[model samples]
Target: MELTLVDLSVARGGVPVLAGVSLSLAPGQALVLRGPNGSGKTTLLRTIAGLQPALSGQVTGAEDRIAYAGHADGLKAMLSVRENLTFWAAVFGMRDVEQAMQAFALLPLADRLAGTLSAGQKRRLGLARLLVTGRPIWVLDEPTVSLDADAVALFAGAVRAHLAAGGMALIATHIDLGLDAAVLDVTPYRVALNGVGFGSSDEAFL
Candidate 1:
């Protein structure tokens, strides 16, 4: 199934940030979202991931097919590396997390508690959760936040493998992962203050 967004308008804190946004991603494809800070990249991704409501338009073919990894690591601090992956796998009705663990080089740290892991290690473990999800579309926001150069390459490799296996990715990151993917700049879709209503609260969650 192809993920399609048509004339989509997404809001942050009940205020419109982007409007007239549209895109489509078929299997084995990836799209990188680009814009300055506070340009609604996170808001758009959250809307597409079904984490929030869209102010207008449609996001079709993405009902239960998206695996989203936002700013947070989404890890259970009390669980060990192996246990964390196992937990996410179970949540998605999967069992084997060996591949996921191996992909991120977590074998050596498998017995380590998530809270005791270094920042980069924790991020890797979080990204590994995507593999066990068995979802077709990956919606990631700054996925390489705490990753080092080598860790970034590992992520790139994982993404490449996922694409080779016919999965799609929609990422919002300033760093280039060296993937031959299409880029979508959301600058044109920025809504003027007078064009849409503004909420008193900021989009702090982003």
Candidate 2:
């Protein structure tokens, strides 16, 4: 399967941020998004992941095929590390969390409450959720935040494994994970304030 974004335009906070963006990702490929702080990388990723709507164009082959990991870790602080993975695993119709735990080295802290773990540990646990997703497309935003070098390497290894298994990834991060991935800079796609652009009143949904 292929994830294709054709002539896509996206907005944030009721204002157009990006326009005329297009890209495609087939199995075993990874695409890294690069842009300045307000360039709409997050907006584009959200649109592709189906978390938000695109003002124009089309996103195909992504329905029920994406596992998104945004800036927020999406963890249940009250749940134990293992329990958290179990919850997410079950949500995606999976039952085993052992492989996910080992992929991120969470076995040692399996019983620890998610809220008690350090920022890096929490991030690791958050990322481990992708392994249990069983989805072929990974849409990640700054996934390495708070992770140490070792943890980043672990995450990179996991991504490599995923790609080797014919999965695709669309990531927005500044750090280099050393993957043979294509980089797409969104700066060129930034919509001019005075230019004709799509508009929306849904300012509350960023």
Cα distance off (Å), candidate 2, residue 93: 0.7
Backbone clashes per model, in order?
A: 0, 0
Q: Evaluate candidate 2 by giving its C-alpha RMSD to the native, one decimal.
A: 3.4
Candidate 2, poorest ten consecutive residues by summed lDDT: 197-206
Q: Give each model a TM-score.
A: 0.95, 0.94
Question: Residue 151 of candidate 2: its Cα lDDT?
Answer: 100
| Over 4 Å off, model 1 | 195-206
Q: What lDDT does the true structure give each of the candidates? A: 0.92, 0.92
Candidate 1 local lDDT, 1-206, one digit each (tens): 99999999998777888999999999999999989777889999999999999999999999899999998999999999999999999999999999998999999999999999999999999999999999999999989999999999999999999999999999999999999899999999998867654343444333
Candidate 1: which pairs clash?
none
